[model samples]
Target: MPDQVTPPPSMHWIVPFAASLSEPCQHALPRLADAKALPNLRRLLGQLQEVARIEGDEYALSMPHERVLAASMGWPDVDGQLPWAAWWAAQDGVKLTADAHWGLLSPGHWLMGRDHLTLLDPATLALSETESRALFEAVRDLFESDGWALIWGASQRWYASHPSLQGLPTASLDRVIGRNPDVWLTDHPQARTLRRLQSEVQMLLYQHPINDTREQAGLATVNSFWLSGCGPVPACTATPAHIQLVNALRAPMLADDMPAWLDAWAQVDNTVLKQALQAVDAGKAIALTLCGERHAVTLATAPAPGLGGRMWQSVKRLTSSRSGPDPVALLNSL
Candidate 1:
């Protein structure tokens, strides 16, 4: 079975795509919007301590959540170059050979814009299990001939283990959504080999029957594969299973559908945030980590214990003469 990331109810809700780089989403979001609109979310934000902030450029090679995952897993290079395949393969009980490194190779479409090529969302590929297996068989020999061990994890997830993966930095699939790969592509010399491999896959796929069928059906054809989550498997602490990850806005945000995003956010605000506030009332230590293209901010339960503690906090706030960060401003910028 595919590993679904569900952390425990000590519940650190990692909300991905909480903000967007698209103008439509940027303009139509919690930004400029009143706090009263999302009461539960607003209350939760006010209640939690703004503990950690991981900031980056929106154009960074990895999404902010990737950095969060790496940190939570206690790995080095927490800046987003996560050894995703190695870690995922480990979860799937795939053996790691001596001195091996691993990476995820996702087969998908690359649409040529007027000037640069943009990678489409992999979900749009709609590859079925049988079709994915067939495509894998066709492409496996190429990777094997290049001295790599490629294994199938799922229709969308293919794993490749090789020593060459060490120190090769590629963008997270989340980071590359609807964007050109060129900007985030690493300057590492080893990247040339992956580029060559990608070109080979494109050429092979161009004449494949799957593309012909997809084209006839008015669907995007699978043209190439993306290499990401590159690194050698490292000794790392386990991610606490109690931390929950809420991905309600991921799909809508990635598709650039602001309306759908608003709807989903409403649902999340009603369901997830409502339950989160309830959890707080029950005195469970929970948190909300809202992740955007460039940053992840973790809002944890403040350590105030009683009325006296609360009064002290208020006094400090007054002495500092600084209000807490405006939730509106933070979400808007994110």
Candidate 2:
């Protein structure tokens, strides 16, 4: 007869994008500032502090979302040059050309603020597949005319290929949304040419039929495109099989919509975190990594200790003058 014993629970990894749970500006929003708003999140943090162990050295400050994804795929330290466009294109079944650089071309609105221009969140564009393809067709010649190849992938995400863009470092879209674009533009030697291309594309799309239709509908016009993740395919090591990511909060966080951010957090807490807790209770190994704008905190299920080990830990705790770092404090620090 086969063995009747069940295997121990496998380790699971959870990554929540843009929790930025304790924003300084949130103090102004009463609903957001209330500790009662995200009960499950707070509960999860408390449980981790009491039962799980924290790995403080894993924190990454001011880290880009793409860098996290890259690291999860075993490609850490690629930072600003992760070649996300190539990865996305491959995921969409698009073949790449030899020695060509690929970039994500997202249609977005650039709002003219009192002092500077802000790139509004791309999600607000509400661009449909047909509309995206039409816009891509309208501007395809502009890129081809400039010796660059343009391919329409998914809605609001087109891929462009250019030889000059190879090895060019571009900021991730997450880093620039709802902020000034000038700061994130590449300072590489070939940036001038890329800037000129951007200008020409903007000019061409200024009065296109699509923009006219959008304007007639009182929607934000798709006046410009953001080119990022520009580079050749990056070499990566082994990719993890089970790294779960929750990013519903990204759009709201970038748009500075506090209520939406809180709602998204609630959903994650109720669904993802709740499930993780149950798994942990069932003797399953699990890990949670909370990421904010500046840092990330990871907590994993603590290993079981024997009676002797427990006694030793208790004695050590009684003799120690200092306490371990507070998980809540660490989260707020992020």
**TM-score top scorer:** 1
- Name every residue pair that clashes in candidate 2: none
Q: How badly does each model clash, as a count of residue pairs?
A: 6, 0
Model 2, residue 302: displacement in angstroms? 2.1
On a 0 to 100 scale, what is the lDDT of residue 38 in model 2? 51
- For model 1, residues 1-334, the per-residue Cα lDDT tens digits are 4543322347778888888768888678754356456667766766677778988988777788878878888877544368887776677666655477788888888998999999888887889988898889999999999999999887888999777777777788888878787776777888888888988998998989977988999999888888888777768635668666788888888888888888888899899988998998776878888888878898888664567876886676466422233456667656
- Span of 10 residues, lowest total lDDT, candidate 2: 53-62
User: What residue pairs clash in candidate 1, if any at all?
Assistant: 7-241, 7-242, 7-243, 8-241, 8-242, 8-243
- Model 1 residue runs over 4 Å out of place are 1-9, 30-32, 78-80, 90-98, 236-238, 310-326
lDDT computed for candidate 1: 0.78
Stretches of model 2 off by over 4 angstroms after superposition: 1-25, 28-39, 46-63, 235-239, 307-328
